[model samples]
Target: MVTLKHDSHEHELNLTEVDAYMVGKGKCGVCEMQINEASSIYKCLREDCPNNSLSLFFFLHKSCAELPKQITHPHHPQHSLVLGREYNQEIVKLTRGSLPHLTACKLCSRQIDEQMWNYFCKACSYEFLLPTNAYLHIFTFSLCIRCAIMEPAIHHEGHKHHRLTLLRRQLSLICDACGITKENDFCYSCLPCQFWIHSSCAASPATIKLRFHQDDTLHLIYSVPHMYRSFTRHCQICKNEVLKDKWAYFCEDSGYFVHITCARTLLAYGENEIKHEAEEEEEDYAQPHPDLLQFPLPSTDSLVANLLAYHQLKNPSTITNPIAEEPVIQHWSHEHHPLVLSEKSTFKGDADSDDDENDDILICNGCTTPILNQHKYYQCIRCNYFLHISCANHLPIKFPAGKCLADPDHSLNLDKLEIKLGRNLSIAFCHSCHLPTNGFGYRCNSCSKLTDIICCLLPDKIKHDSHKHALVQHFNHPSFKMYQNICTACLAPVLDGFDYRCETCIDVQIHQHCAMLYPKSITHRFDSHTISLLYPPIYYKGIKYCEICELQVNPEAWLYWCRHCDQCFHPNCIRAWHNMKLGDKIFNGGIHRHKLTLVAIDKDRYPQRIHKSLACNQGHDNGSSLDVYLECAGCFFIL
Candidate 1:
């Protein structure tokens, strides 16, 4: 019991020392809590005090009337937590931690904004902001409502049959809701069901609409047992096996299925990353479109099925070689006609070669390898196509299945020949690189109609220091109208062969090998600093001229641009002035009779037979300020 005077009157009151139950329930005025119990209390002897309302009395607990000098929190191992008030701006600095922006609450996984007053721990770097009064309830369960979702078990919309148990230790299990192997420290598991899900995957949405399969909506299937168990499932988008034990999406009516990660990938990338099916189907395919060079190659199975059936009906003979004894057969690359085996001793050079038969010189058209009189070869006399013995037997007819350099999403298949009266088109050229070849060719079902074999076999990724972005190989850009295919680098027609194109920038194309040939560093006589290759020379307000040749260099063309010297040299000029040594023999194209040897001119002693300067038929001037000229030894014709 205690007594105190209030309003000049003496009164008696009851008071007792605080206990655990009392400490837990007593309301405090300062912290506005029903718990904290460190500060002393006094009871008034009088029944009431001035400014009292609703029988309420002034009470203090811990630092209610005053302020907490410091506080120690388990979450913060280093710095002491301190109370902050409106007036004590200096003491207000003792917050738990700081959050620069609105971030997710660790307990609830809900977003918390920066406007709220926060407690900061400098040592542990913990940020504790009172999001709402509800967060205080977390102290009882030793977790958040979100964390409590995994306590004994949690029922997610993704998984309805059984509740998922919280897995606190590192899990070696793979997530059933997504096909990714789990290496995470924590996840949810159904031990009896042998199913696991990532905490992230558990938070996935119920339904999704993917770009690839836009016609239908997909419903999430939480476990393999919940999926269509009657048939083996494969992802339609990625064409990969969907494990029966994994989570995936399925459209019941359409039978469309996709991987969880693949769907997320499309959603994350948005429409730009999606391959437009409508755009690919927009081609006005000619009836009986047998022009193998056309965009979008004809179906391989149909063409090959017809060709093989026709070949079987036409020729059934099995010719076996007596020596080495391998079956001599007709190959698809050579018109499906019988190619008689010719041994090294029987090779009579090439019929078209100007060299005498005894000269022992020939070239195999297949590999472009020189065939000496001693090497065995295969030749089609009717077509004049020669191939090395090995090339004829083992050359690939189609590219392997994968996303080609030309089209990122489409899988490439070889172009199938349409046999017309026992012969396929021999003059066929690769639509991408315009190079004529009777070798393996490729086409993508997704984007391209046809592509050259050489271009399809190119490495999918290449690194070049001059290029800022990793240039991806594109077979043929559909954006270009017919006859409008142009290489921005050389400013020439790029109807054939693939271009290493920038995925980020449209209209940026580089020749595959040309881009790879850019030098990392180069020393020039005119420039003091070592210059490096620049894929695209920076275009100033005015046109940039090549420092070496003085010709206006196309900004898109590769240049050896020096940052220190601020000079740009065309790639051709770099090779001509820096790489080419004096006395190098080179051809001057159709205007010369023989190869010309490069020579420096003695300005005073000009040859009588040679003109001072001459221009080629194409109107390109031969005169250069740096190097003199190449002249014919026989006629002294200046080239």
Candidate 2:
């Protein structure tokens, strides 16, 4: 029996049978890769196989064929899983379109390409989509490539009784194994003893190359029982107590013991030796029985690829001709047939009302927003698909040439989105704007992490409608007070990845999407008159206040200010107010005459309505009356 753990869950597997076999063209069932005819192969010979018991048995590479007797996977620690080589008929039958269940490559989060051969576990249906070039480190390591690469378990000499498993969350506790007090969010823990150790301590090497005493080799000491306690014992490096029952490196010949923490600092000092050893090793060959700590650290590119490969299906490539001719008939977001370019308006508009909806209701499917004013748009009559000229003209076929705010050093390229399966969701959302789309954007080359089209194309400086001077694109502010950076427009913490900072003004920062807000003017439900854009440095009375939110507005942030009434509104509040539909009701008010309904103010119909403030029974103790009252049609009272 073999147990494989995935997504913090355990799965049990059984190897029914094995035999020498051959398969042509298709990928191996165990590795999800093409098998070279010249290479040795094996097949499952079980009469009643778990994988559908199909007429044609599943095949595996010689390296992938070997199965362990009984295994306990970190993901599934409760029970052991047995490796099964049979092809799962249940998953194969759904090969017509897509599986009803959303399945991803267990090793990487990348969606399993439909109908492709993969290593599948019957218990969890956890699949592995392997790269054809991947080869085993050695037959000695029984774990699959995915499990081997991701958060692999470690056998430290300090905790010889159990293997310490790598965990992602922070555990604030004194390490039982090392007896060291450290503040790290990530650490390795022994599930059985609840013993935790810092990741750095877990990764400590077997031997330390000392700076002070080069002649002596400091070997790591694992067992430090309470019986070995002595008052005179002290770390040679830190001069601190080498606590009993704590592991440390000791040079017995030199009569010195160094704490594990002290030994880790020597890593930087011994970097030259580390590099020299790595250089001496054969490029393609590794030692058959290398020390647990001796494996070469993965490169930056490899680490990034490990993450990005989870979702990306296609091979990443640069876009040679970015400004290619717009397809006359094509698919932008929809995927039925090619959407033909047409000028006819497909939007159904209200005929009688001269409202803003009549003007801005025609939405572009690409940006998934209303087409403002006379911007030329393309529409498909049959499918009712539409696209803005700007989105259509600048549609990226692949990732674009731009610097990511996340990783500024590496130039990002665009790629088509490979939407994850099992999510009852449509449309790819931009991390910046939070809008749905099917356009191409920049992907981080190192990690394959994606950035939306709108964010990738932002200029270094933007001349926004609300600002007089251009707001510069900046990383986190050096003087940010909160743990997380905040956006000035919404007066909320900027939890999203990046922000646009106004260099001209102090502490003037907004999200990139907020800076690119369109429509210079808008009529908010909170106010009667149309609100105009106002940038930072909004000089006013003692303190400016926003009537919509009834909160104090930061004098140095962009606002939708009305000069006539001296009213101010946060940019986000204005957008939220504009998107609300009529007939909307609110439950809470100062005094409840009726639920506040969203109705147009008709001055002509309600001629006798007084402008004077009304005193409510629910008024505050200070005799404050409800201001700006409106008549509720249902209750026939001021609300």
Q: How displaced is residue 93 in candidate 1, in Å? A: 15
Candidate 2 C-alpha lDDT tens digits along 1-639:
432322111222333333222222233454454333346555444456554232243455555545343556655555455543223333444354354224443333334443433334334434434365543221111234334233557887778899988775555678764786665435778888887887666655566444333444556776543323422356655556676667787665544567877655544332212122123345523433221111111211121122223213232442432433354645444566665554444334453433321232445544434543334566665645566654554444454334554455656655655433221212355544443344455567875656665555444554443433446766543445477655656545665445677675655677755555434666644567977766543444345556644456654456778878888876644443221122334444444646754332322223333334432233412231212232365665543
Model 2 local distance difference test score: 0.47
Off by over 4 Å in 2: 1-328, 332-335, 340-360, 381-384, 396-440, 444-446, 463-470, 477-485, 503-505, 522-530, 536-557, 561-570, 573-639
lDDT minimum window of 10 residues, candidate 1 = 136-145
TM-score of 1: 0.27
**Which TM-score value belongs to model 2?**
0.33
TM-score of each: 0.27, 0.33
Candidate 1 Cα misplacement greater than 4 A, ranges = 1-152, 155-163, 168-172, 181-186, 203-206, 209-215, 222-241, 262-292, 295-639
Model 2 residue 219 lDDT? 66
